[model samples]
Target chain A: MAELTDTAQQRATGLLRDYGAAVRAKRIRAAMYFVALVICVLAASWSGEVDLRKFVEGLPRFGSYFRDITPTLRPATLGSDIAEWYWNFPVWLELLLETLLVAYVGTLAGATLGFFLCFFTSANISGNRTVSFVVKRALEFCRTVPDIVFALLFVFAIGLGPVPGVLAIAIHTAGALGKQFAEVIENIDLKPVEGLRSTGANWVDQIQFAVLPQVTSNFASYVLLRFEINVRGATVMGFVGAGGIGKELLGSIRQFYYSDVSAILLMIIATVVVIDLLTERLRHRLLGTAKV
Target chain B: MKPRIAEPCDIDRLRTAYPSAFAPGYARRAAALAGISAVVGLFIFGVVWLGFSPSALVQGISKLGVILKLMFPPTAGQHMLVYLQALAQTLSIALLGTMLAALVAFPLSFLAARNVVGRWLLRFLTKRVFDAIRGIDTLVWALIFINVVGLGPFAGILAVAMSDVGAFGKLFSEAIETASPKPVEGVLSTGASKIQEVRFAIVPQVLPLLLSQVLYYFESNIRSATVIGIVGAGGIGLYLSNEIGQQSWDHVSFIILMILITVAIIDAVSGRLRRSIIGAQARS
Candidate 1:
């Protein structure tokens, strides 16, 4: 300690002082943030009319919903006869299957349309910036307007049914997937596109021979992801008279049929889980093959 | 990335070089074509199944044109202030719900993390719980909550929070699992308790990423709150749906404008914040 240089010791104290100041500043900032957040929370609780007392009282009511939702399993009927637990299981399954098909058709149509539009939107691909901007904005508008809203409009125009639901889901999907697919296109290795173009290839040939190969796997992955989301969207589109199990679910809720509500919800949850699993596997397979 | 055809080769030369391929010898191409045709066929079937009528579409468009003409001179009508209030409520619902989700999920995220949770079974169960929660859409949750709480923004808030709990739990836990252990180990080496190590090391590392994700969701939830409102939960969406039903095209257009503006503003603000957060992380 005696051998330490005077400047070195001075430097050490200065560093310590700076560190203390920084820590103090950070603490002050953190405290202010906490206070601000608390105030915001309190204000929102009031504005949103969140009554903690009422919530606590209604907590059991919420719990009862889940209890009702759970299938009853008597000892005698445990696995051998599950009728009472799910009386409308077969009909609900068909409606749920219809829901799945709606999502599938919507996703397929949307992704294909998006595939064409994304090229025009991608900065790296489009030749005309004005066209690109318009296309991008159109896609944004398509997505920004909720599928339910679109469903409502179409229901008004074309009458209430599955067509409106499918159209709504498709437009929403195109809006979302076009943006994502464009990003994928922009991120691709430009060397291939440049190579193809230098070889006297037209735009179509370049996209087909070079760009498509690079992006098809990713495009497929995004489409699958969109399909998963569309399933959820299609479920709710029925609230606006668009067709699917959502129509029945809404009807059940409207009529206060607690048993049917639970039954329909169970089927929806099951369908979502199964679709997620199936799509996850498909994405993995596509990516795995692409990698190889 | 493999080039499908050798570059610098003429189209004619390529065709001559691969005559059999030109006649559809490539299984991949044939399969792709088949898939495309099938998709097109399915689209046609879906249209037919929908009982699509061109005449109806044309009639609908003309009706829509009348609405659009009325909508041109957009007026807020007598409910301008009411519309504004509803919009604010939607924003609040989104904000409050997102924060609530973050608060609930923060601690549970640790339990869900594979690195933090000791037992594989516990982690697996936690993950599945998150998945199940996330499986039910916010609109469904909104409908369910409306049943319990009656109706209003309260239901919307709860719906958003519940769905976000599932999402944030999964995302936050995954972020925690991906965090490097060196800093945690360093903190522990100073005789710190497990809690102290986590508080000092892990939280600092993952908080930014978690918050950015939460922020992004907050923006999207604004749109969701509106959608859920259509189900009678509460928000401007209820008003929008009402106007649409009554064929008050002007009010509907006004509501649409407000929502679009609100969403655009939120998207821009959140985008900047996300960038700044990423920049800070990069610098540090």
Candidate 2:
């Protein structure tokens, strides 16, 4: 009877100890999260000029603004040359085509450049450390500057047209795709290249026969993906006066022509959907997963 | 039979094995591959066609040098306060927009994932919706929102949110599809409903990935907020563009510096947080 009582006492202590440890852990986690939340709130308030009073005062304005937006779907003014506005359809279509053309050329150029640069950029393949460092930094600098800034600068330098937009997109794509391509190259199996090297093949010959074949499918898929992104980018180049559908969209917004804006948006959405579908199909085919 | 003298047959075999060393086709293939070097020629042609003369560059460099001479030590005059205010606005816009997008995209991701939805048509349509939204750049989305909501940070917020919705949906769905199926199967076998299974199993598996992606997008959205500000969506970008337009190169340099510093800080913090989250998930 005495031993049985002792065993029960030990069991009770162990259970309590386990419960205490769990509670302590839970408290620590909760405190850490609470501290983090406080920091976030403080940082946001400090950086965003957020003040309760100002926000409260602005609430009514928000309501009035919603009221102002009620007549958003205004019909075309009865006598106001709807025909002239309707003529914009052809122009919009042409602009859409131009956007596609720019994306195509840019993607092709960028992919070609990126493919070659991948060899030099890959740490395993590079001949010299200095060369790799310079190439990597150059790509970083190219990508760090947003594409819009590039478009703006190109517009200033090259004068207005789709040329600047294409060049801008190409430069950006080269930077982005070059990094991705280098990663793909680095991840490739080295056995094939080693086999070629053991056969007394030169470095260039080894890369050509072994490395290129292994990564071609992945490289193709990346290029297709970049092309899809570039299509969207090309459409927006018009905002900087580099040229595309964005110009018309900007015009509609400036004039407050809601219907026309809607039409242009519809066109853009449709174009994007079609391109996306095509890319999906192409990617599957290139990856040899067509049956799947 | 082997005792008969073998005169350098190994070398002879090696030479015979790769006869392409002497073949013209080997050189032709090399040339074709190396043809990419011709891009330099195209670059030169573009320079000439675009009238980018070396002299013009040199002249512009001198002009830029003169401008740099004035932008000394970054003036913290009366406009400093205004600059800080605008910077804060930009950060808030990015934060609010990212939060909104994350909230919406987190649940939608499960519906969009092929493995979760278990229907090709639903998956395809859901993915297409994401694609359509993402296919329009943030700047264009800003323009659309500006028309709908009028000009302000509110418009910028909406624009960023809309653009991110597509991106987040895609990223989240990919994460869901990649999650381990074991826990999900176990939960389902316990007579749990589909929703319960997903809630108890898949959510835990994907939560860390979703958080990391959301954090990354937030870092990115900060940069994007600046861009949309150029279109009068009310952020530091508006000030930056105005400075550029006014040819205040000094102010432009200062603003660019601010952007760089802010982005760097956010990236470092988010990177640490992401790693910790991932580490915890791995441990669990």
Candidate 3:
């Protein structure tokens, strides 16, 4: 009995020691992480000139800017106040329409290009490994460079117009959508594809008969999502003189037309909300029907 | 919408039972045709309205080619130091901005999460607020901040932080909502208070996922920081815009190359960090 108790006590002590070592190691790691985080924060704040005092001082100005942008209204002249707030309603509407059209055209063109490119990029269908690898990298380059930067480049090359805006959005959209489409294609069940191949169907026929049916609805949904993003992008394309409501917004901002700035922002926000709702509904409908 | 069972050797019965399968209805066919026509019509109309002609495209491509040629020999000109410093500043902006946003968002996300916040109206309001703020792009925020706080990287930081607050809030709340209830129950069984339960249970469960998300956002915000600089909020983007204006294609290419490299490096590093965090969590 004495020998057995000694062995049990020794085992208990060993287990406790191991536990203590594990916990101490964990604490050290945590401490190191904390130190590293503090260092990064201090260095970043210093380099970025993140002065809390300056921000606090400017806080009032930020508040007042918001205040100034809010359109004043009284019960007596509400209609006139509203009308005056949106004084350039017609021109703004025209520009807004152009922005929508730019998004539409950009999305369509991008989706079409992405549709073709995705097949070549997808690992399952890519006939040539080198081509797939190159296409993937190109898509990454396109998406990594912000659409606005692309607009800046296009605006430089093509001159100021909606065309540059369209091209910029299209290129970015293709990159973004192509990756998504390729992923969808890669995830597809390959049994049908194999069956088609075994039946002596050519590559094109296999894709058409087996792959397209599985991925069309998904592709459409992705295209709609891209369109929503591109609309927001197109709104800002005008800042670079690529043509859109953004040009007007930028002008008002630079000239300090506070009311006009607020008015245009509201219109843009409303348009985005509406488009979001509409596209969401369309996507649901498409996916739901596809399932049925 | 139920599938119809057709009697074998009864073609007439099958046709009557599933008429739409044999021949689409007039209304359906017309609607389909109209949809196709509308799409084609809009494409043509957009082509004309946007002046997207083949001739113009060919001309623009040649101009782009010329610009590309100018960009081939990438050089930083005389302002290499300035460009490098600006690059560092961009990274700082993204890092600081993301940290600040995550700090601000941590508490707010609990208020937005359904499992944490019992009140439906509060959750709804919080979500809508997030949506509204997120709807405004980071550059727009940068422009506004420049007006309010004056030009420089400070504005860029504030703008990035402000925009990311919305995104982080939404994402963090979703992460919180998905945390398992078992942990909360276990914590409660120990007679822990509400705050204690959350601190000891929910947070631990969700922290790894949230950190991974924050890391991902940090990587993307670096990209955004570069763009926001073009609006004069401060960073290498300011350098880029200046060079572009001066028609210094080589310098512009160099700055762009720097951005791409920085972004790629950060992406790889952050991805590793996120994987490690997730792996540690799984092991635990």
Candidate 4:
């Protein structure tokens, strides 16, 4: 009985020793992370010249604005003429359509460009390593810059219009979709392509017979997904004078037209809902997972 | 019998058995597609001719080079304090927004998950809600909230929260869907309640992934928050835009540098945190 008790105690000690080591490692990691975060915050604060006093001063203004919004949302003027002016159906509908068109055109253009690049960038599909590397790096650079910055640059280049917005969205989408497409291509079953190659098919023929078929559905799904994203992006591109519903929204806000703002929000929400439903159905159908 | 001279009937049977080798159908389809491509090519040429000038592109590139020259040797001068404050505000907005979205999404994601919800209609509705929200960019949400709340960090926070709710919900649901079912089943077999099954089994399985995603979003939100600020939701983006509007290209460069450094640091830290969490899970 004494020997058994000693054995049990020794085993418990061993377990505790292992647990202690894990705990210590965890603590050290946590401390290192904390230190890193602090260093980053300090560096940013120093570089940006952030003042604590100004932040404190600004806090009250924020409070006042929040307070104003609550009373402004009250429905006391529901039946008033002002409400009618704010919620004009034709204006809202026109803006919504413009936004949708920008998103649609952008997605189509982006997907087309991206699909071409995907083959060149994909190591599994590209005939040469050097071409794949260059294409992949180009895509990475394209995607690294935020879409809004791209919009700003395009607006500067093309002059202000929905054209700039469309172009910006297209460029960003191409980068993002290209990367996703390449990944999809990389993960595809290579047997089919190999078999085509064995039959003396050239690169283009092999891709057409094997690679394209496997990824077509996925590509379609991503395009639809990008369209949905572009819709939202196109809406706000107007703030930079890139024309859309966002321009109207911005104008309304500047004029303090609260009722108009509410109307626009409702319109946007409704449009988004419709698009969401359509895409979901399309995805399910394309993926062949639709339930009987 | 086979050594006898091949008859015309036997040759016909062989040709019919392998139609692909002898068929004209594939060639005809390829020719039709080529015709369609020609039409598309003409349409593209028409549009390009209508919309743009090649000389204008050359002029624009030269102008871009001049603008880029003005941006070099970034100056952090008199307005440094203002820029810093705005940067801090952006960080706070990102942090608050990410936290709010993560907290809200953690519960809603379960409802969106097909495995967790079990009811197809309910799950479908929740999922669609996420998609609709996500379909709209964070900038749009910022614009909406700027209208609602009146141009400040508060609006920025709300926008980030709203957009992240959609994104986090989708991501979290995907993670939940991909989690190991064995643990959930084990809990269920032990007479655990549905909620308990999720709590004891599903949550643990997906928590690390969910945390990592949330952290990544936080880093992404920092960049997004800056962009929204350009539209007057209050952040360094507003300052950056202002500087650009004034053609203070030096200051614009300075702000860009600040953003780059901040983003890089956040990315590194978050990446480390993700690795550590994954490691812990592996050890367990």
Task: State each candidate's clash count.
Answer: 0, 1, 0, 3
Cα error, candidate 2, residue B207 (Å): 0.7
Per-residue lDDT of model 1, residues A135-178, tens digit only? 99999998999888988887887787787788788889999999
Tens digit per residue, CA lDDT, model 2, A1-292? 9999999999999999999998899799979977986786567655644445654555565465435433343366633545443547888898898778777777777777777777888987778888899888788666656777667656665567777777788888998899999999999889998899899999899889999988888888998899888988888888888777888888876786756766677788899888989998989888985223
What lDDT does the true structure give each of the candidates? 0.87, 0.78, 0.91, 0.79
RMSD of 2: 6.6
* Model 1 chain B worst lDDT window (10 residues): B43-52
Q: Give the docking tier of candidate 3.
A: medium
Q: What interface RMSD does each of the candidate structures achieve?
A: 1.6, 5.3, 1.2, 5.7
Q: After superposition, how far is residue A11 of candidate 4 from its true place, in Å?
A: 5.4
**Model 4 chain A weakest 10-residue run by lDDT:** A65-74
lDDT of 3 by residue, A7-54 (tens): 999999999999999999999999999999999989888888888999
Worst 10 residues of 4 chain B by lDDT: B43-52
Q: How far off is residue B271 in model 3, in Å?
A: 1.1
True contacts kept of each: 0.50, 0.28, 0.52, 0.13
Task: At residue B73, give the lDDT of candidate 2.
Answer: 59
Q: Can you write out model 3's per-residue Cα lDDT over B179-208, one digit (the tens) per residue?
A: 999999999999999899889989999999
For model 1, residues B128-166, the per-residue Cα lDDT tens digits are 899989988898899888877878988889899999999
Each predicted complex: what DockQ?
A: 0.56, 0.24, 0.61, 0.19
Model 2 ranges with Cα > 4 A deviation: A1-27, A49-87, A192-203, A289-292, B1-85, B113-128, B177-182, B185-195
